[model samples]
Target: MNRRRFLQSSAALSLLTAADFAPWQAISAFARELDDFVRGPAVKDHPLRQVSKHVWMIFSPDGFPTPENQGMMCNITFVDTAEGLVVVDSGTSVQIGEMAIRQIRKAFNKPVIAIINTHYHGDHWLGNHAYVDAYGDSLPLYAHPGTIQAIQGVQGNMWRTLMEQWTNQATIGTRVVPPRLPLKNGDELKFGDVTLRMHHFGVVHTPYDLCVEVLEDGVTLIGDVAMDHRIANMDDGSYLGTFKAYDSLEKMGSRIWLPGHGEPGAGVLKWNRRLFEGIYQPCEQAIKDGLALEETKARVLKDPRVSSQARDTKGFETNIGKYVSLAYLEAEAAGF
Candidate 1:
């Protein structure tokens, strides 16, 4: 099922218990169980559901990585075009990426013409190894320039190293393959039957974040810019950039939206604004008054509009702290 139906269904979270996990434990659970997630069970082939005739999205469950849920905490989107296949954001590792590609081949005969990396996050692009190995490195991969530069530099290597340690040894041969194509904002192209319009906003979710629009189907493939139900990590995210991305999406007026994480829909953008604003006003005020990091975090946690959905069952040190810390840093840097 697509994100819309999956999230709307009462059983969407049947297996996951959304308790607060330590940042490392919740977000990097995949690294901890890399072996089990790759070789343990039927972890690879989750389910790939159709968003449109030309679009299919693999919706991951909502929660930090865990053995029970595996490391499929992020969604993968693949599109079928007239000429070939187009993929957006590979999975976290070689195994997960392989499973996604296997599922893609099961449905069509098209050779993948392009793979798009929405940002610099390893989970979104490290799966590039699988596609490169299968289709050959000549297969054109697309991403923002900053994303390409980061992956080709030491920053990418550090993220890769961290992934290997977190997944135990499961990430062993998963090379960090940078995208071959640098896509500019508003670049439009046609692949078979679908028409693609690219969108870029500076330093919202990351230095290089790209969203795509399928003009043919009124569908938008937005990366990590928008999230629903849960609080998104803002350590590298910008409070103002997030709102700018939302405004861009609103202008596009697409009925279908596939998020990098969380369930897909227009609602994702709507709630993103609410969450950021709730944290920003409180955090901004604290920073203006010369409150310390800990004090700012405390103020954000007390504001339920932002923290209520993301609060853990027993810990005051919630994922909300990640947002608070990031927002506070941005405020200080901007001289709020």
Candidate 2:
């Protein structure tokens, strides 16, 4: 069977199975477990540690993964300057955001003057309300035009979903907050001697993906655009576009990459681009061969490149299936 038929059949089978199984109950149970794990410990508030004279990073622990999967962790960074502090991405929950803020306060007496949201994802921007509630009108939030629309368009559904997946109803009732400011591309934010430049990388991870480059500090917070090749999520439109944007990042080198998840690394742009290419080439070949979706997914999963990454082998098949489905749609639209 070809790719299209396989997907159609698989989708039909999935729907039938879903109708018979109580997946929501399983999901609810897993969500509870995740909430317990995420809320188990509060990371001690540490003062801002300076990376450069003008740049300081407030490191906070990762947030719980969305209920969709396990082992994924989210992170946010804060850059401090003479004028005030500029947070890179607000965390998933208000408590996480507040904890990050407290750490910033421990290092610098200045208030948080600006927030740059890398994208519209709930994990990155949902904590904006926390800063707004604390600072009132003193804080200015920035994000790409597309990102702003995503946050406003969802009407907080994404936030609610994340809260439900990561935390229980009680926690959700307590800590969830909304975004305050909407930003555009090419917006330059100044804080004393430090200047944070925001640039939209067209449509990559999302239509509104933005990268923040600190000129003086030589650090780029490249949001989810730079993944660790561990089960890359392509549910968002433009998976290939993400590859192109990452290519641009590779050309525009930075000293260190502050990613939204995983450990901080150097030369992330190049590394991510290579990973994207590795995934893209095989999928493209499978498309050319007219393989069915399941065949393509199985082929991709068995490839040495897929196994090289530290991800569950079984999970790779599922991730590849998703990528193949989205990539097929993209290729079709482009008249491939």
Candidate 3:
């Protein structure tokens, strides 16, 4: 049979040609099924929610690291400018990035002028593959210098390990793509119609972290420094610096806030502050009482005030203890 007939006859088209279309002929129907199984709702259900005229957000609820969400436990924000588009944080995998691109196409056909990663985490920047696939090397990714260093160094390896462990076939085509452009504190970037004010709160969520404030939209993408419903993950940061970062964010006076995770994007600074203080004070008292890490963890978890902040997610339970232990360590290292 001819290649087309063989394809129509349901032969494995791999035997036909080395052409890209051959692969599609073989797997198109099955691929659609698999894609549906892995990916979340189409543009209709998870459509980008508008924060402002220029600012839009896609919020991903906390859940297992499936292909559907691509470990995008955090929210992704995009800004439309007069020139093109600016993505606040890419998704967790190549597929997620492609989905971001599709969503962008659904709204605007402009080129992505920049993708600014608030930090080095893969969930925030790994979806770079989609942009890279579309624009190739011309796509300029911006982040703090520390972000590049960490991803190029140890944290990059850590993310790979975690994705492999948690995701199913979701992470199959995704790999780490670190940012290329290094941004500094107080740097002003004018891209189309919006100006980005990149603010770095010293040694907060990550040693190299930043929050992008959209000067035109009056919205600030505060990265992971603040979260809603879930207690902040203390796996890669400091208790003292977080409080300081919160102080800085609260003073930004932006009309709207976008967190790495959460809904509505408003009052994030206040909610994170309350959770941070609630967890910190008890942690300090435990350290002052000469409690060990384990004891401090126990005290923090049992504390009626902060216990409510620990959230439960699919395949994972919020371990408030880790936050407590990290807080104790940060306090001890700073001699506070």
Candidate 4:
């Protein structure tokens, strides 16, 4: 069948399979079902929530599945300074972005002089238009050059697919607004007393994955790089690269980690890195042993390291299975 027909068929089959499973069966099921859509509803309580003295986290309950439960959350930190405000990743939607702006205004009257996009993912950058469109071109937005390309490349498809999947609304056409300044690795942005160092690890989670480290606060807002110990999404073809990025973060030990999803914590970098190495390495090794796919999966599932995190293992297993299939294809290509 043609590509379009195949995608349609696959989508239908997936929907059917999901219907058979329990509603809210697992985060994996929810994510797969909502893969094409932007997560969460708009939250509108301003007056920024203070995560730290110098760091204020504007919580946008946008991507959360439930209105009361804050799941797919995004955070923006503000540094108290005379220069201007430094905002981190914008949430998934226009409403979320606007809400965050209102909160930022309450905390500091100064203009948001700069914004650092952690990556080009829609949830992170889609709300950017809301900021620029409101503040005019005065405020500069920074991201890796790869981020600019990815955003521009997926603009049309992102608008169409997101509307169809999330809101169940169809669009005739759509346009994407790009960020202002393209950032490079080691780029330093300063606002009054706060200084943020941008680090670009090429092609990790995404082609332009960027991490923002607040020197004074000692907090690092890692886009989607060091996420919670759930299944890592690799639909964008950066599975191996993502694992490598996780390794790098482990080495750069930090006190606090602000991930894209879940609550912020300390020492999560070590936990996340260990999980990737323990899980991915053995799985890759099992494939090399010429084990059948099912057998390999069963062996990995029963392994002590795997069973420890098995409660959150469903999504990991699903993603790893796909990775295994892809690895097999690569081996075949190499005439293995």
**Model 4 lDDT per residue over 1-336, tens place:** 533335545765676687774454554554444443433345456456665656667654343323342222455556555687777777655555667777776657788777778776666666665687568767687788877776778652574356434542221112245666888888887777877888777776667788887778777788777666555454453546766676676566656788775456785565555555555555566667877666665765566665676565335644766654554443334444
lDDT of 1 by residue, 1-336 (tens): 532234334232431344433354543454434423333233558778988878888887754444445456678898888899889988777777888888888888778888999888887888887899899989898998888998889757776666655665455456678887899799987886888888998878886789988888888998887766656666677898888778877988899778888777767787778778888878789978989989887787677765664453222246666667778888787782
Angstrom error of the Cα, residue 23, model 1: value is: 45
All candidates: TM-score: 0.81, 0.76, 0.82, 0.73
> Candidate 1: lDDT of 200?
92
Model 3 lDDT per residue over 1-336, tens place:
433234444533443444555555556665444433443222223567788988888788863365455566768888888889889888777767777777878888788888999887777887786788787878889999999888878877687557644664355445567788999999988976789899997887888888999987778888887776666666878878888887777777788888887764667777777777777777788777888888777776676556665553222154555667677777776664
Q: Measured by TM-score, how close is model 2 to the native structure? A: 0.76
Q: Of the candidates numbered 2 and 3, which has the greater TM-score value?
A: 3
* Model 2: how far residue 268 lies from native, Å: 1.8
Candidate 4: give its CA RMSD in angstroms: 11.6
Candidate 4: regions farther than 4 A off: 1-42, 60-73, 155-160, 167-175, 237-240, 251-253, 312-336
Q: In model 4, where is the ten-residue run with the lowest total lDDT?
A: 167-176
Q: Return the TM-score for candidate 3, rounded to 2 decimals.
A: 0.82
- Cα error of candidate 4 at position 302, Å: 2.6
TM-score of 1: 0.81
lDDT tens string, model 2, 1-336?
533335445654665587675566665564444433433223345345565556556543443454332212456677767887788887665555677778776667888887888877777776676688789856777777666666777735666465645643322422334445665666777777888877677777777778888888777787888754344556774867877776677666678777776545685565556555656666677777877767766766666665565363223545666776776556545544
Model 2: per-residue Cα lDDT at residue 50: 62
Query: Which candidate should be chosen as best, given lDDT against the real structure?
Result: 1
